[model samples]
Target: MELIGQGMEGAVYDLGDGRVRKIWFDRRPDDVRPLKAFLDELPPLPFRTPRIHEITADADGQAVSEEDLLTGTALQESGVAEEQALDAFVAVVEALRATVAGPASKALPVLNQPFWREDLSWGEALAALVRRRAAESRHHFRRDVPDFDNLLETLTTRLATIEPDRLSVVHGDICQPNLLMDGPRTAAVLDWGFYSTAGDNTFDAALAAGFFDMYGPDAQRLDNLLLDRFERLGHDRQRMYLYRAAYAITTATIYDADAGDGHYVWCVGNLNRLPR
Candidate 1:
């Protein structure tokens, strides 16, 4: 096997055949079974999603799973025209929005783990998540943000105003790396489960547009382009900004508990730049 991809959660390896093995850093077989079950039952969409062939344990008892390798260059690295990339990105979100999740998917875990409550609306749950994450990690960001509390309060207030949404599969992380492209079309969507949930489809739309470009030198301009595209397509621009801010705050300390990583820095910068 050859190491192909790595991230905060796990490492992925090519299994020599037409499959890959993901060695989870902190998950167990049972931990991901629900995700596998849910993906297995998904109705066909315009693009391919993950398929977990099986989950097992390595010698160290860490979860190891084999899955079909849906091959494509990541969308951002595929050299497709910017317009084409943006179109594919928005198309994927729209596809998920149009397709409804069945009852079996209700068991899929959301962004905040066991803290996720079923009764809360999508926006309400996100607001609660902001509170939970802030309680644990605010100290690391307060000095830099100065008005961290005020910003957080405002974010939660805006979150509370989101209208109730239809239940659809929300792919919480739809950034460049997760989107694979063959030519100008989306070949597959990879790496599910960190924030996969059964919730409002608009949440996916908002986050997908923001995640399109978050760190490049032209990031702000590209972000504006995607936001404009979504707005023209009827997505509320303010709500997209609100969701982006909430995502930054809630995930600032997720990959680095002490806010010491580049992603944390990105989150802090995003907070500082929020609509003032």
Candidate 2:
């Protein structure tokens, strides 16, 4: 097997059997149960999700899975036309929405793990993250306000009051790189490691909006496309936009903490778009 990609939580390997092995980092016995539960519940959802062939738990309780690797190129590397990318993104989102309505969908827990149910609304979740960041910053650097303080405060104030009644199972992380496109449509949604059941569909849309803002020249086009789809689905455009801004900030903060300057650059791009 050859290592193809790696991240904070897991590593992907080209397993030579026309498949990929995604092995999670060493985990405690307690963590295995939820992961196993997630893997077991993945196949029944009604969307373009990867099919897991097998799941194996090592003696030390770490989990690994071999699954059908998406044969098509990732959207980031596809060199697809902007209009086509937008269409594919919309199709995938619709498919995911349908999946959330399926009876088996609720088996998988919300993406943020143990604290999932507590923050059922997107705004609540963002507020919790902002509060956690503030506390962490205070503990690490006393007195003065941190760079993220203002951004977090503004986002929390704006989003905290917005009601999040639109619920769906979201792909938690919906960036371009994780989406695979074949021909002109999304073939499969790879990487279910961050899948969740509690977030609103807007959470996924926000992720898509943030990605287009980061990579595409016609950033507003992607935003419009997503909002149009949400409207067709009967979602409020204003709320979706709010979640998009919040999601962008939340995403950038995670990357900035884990990775470094590259993520900071991404953070600034998203931060600049927050509604003044």
Give the top-scoring candidate (lDDT).
1
What digit string (tens of lDDT, one per residue) describes model 2 on residues 88-171? 776666666654332233444433433344434555655665555445333222222235566566767876676655556577
TM-score of each predicted structure versus truth:
0.91, 0.74
Worst 10 residues of 2 by lDDT: 136-145
- CA-RMSD of model 2: 4.4
Give the Cα-based TM-score of candidate 1 against the true structure. Answer: 0.91
Backbone clashes in model 2, listed as residue pairs: none
Report the CA-based lDDT of candidate 2 relative to the real structure. Answer: 0.61
* Candidate 1 lDDT over residue span 29-71, tens digit each: 8887888898897889988888999999988888999998889
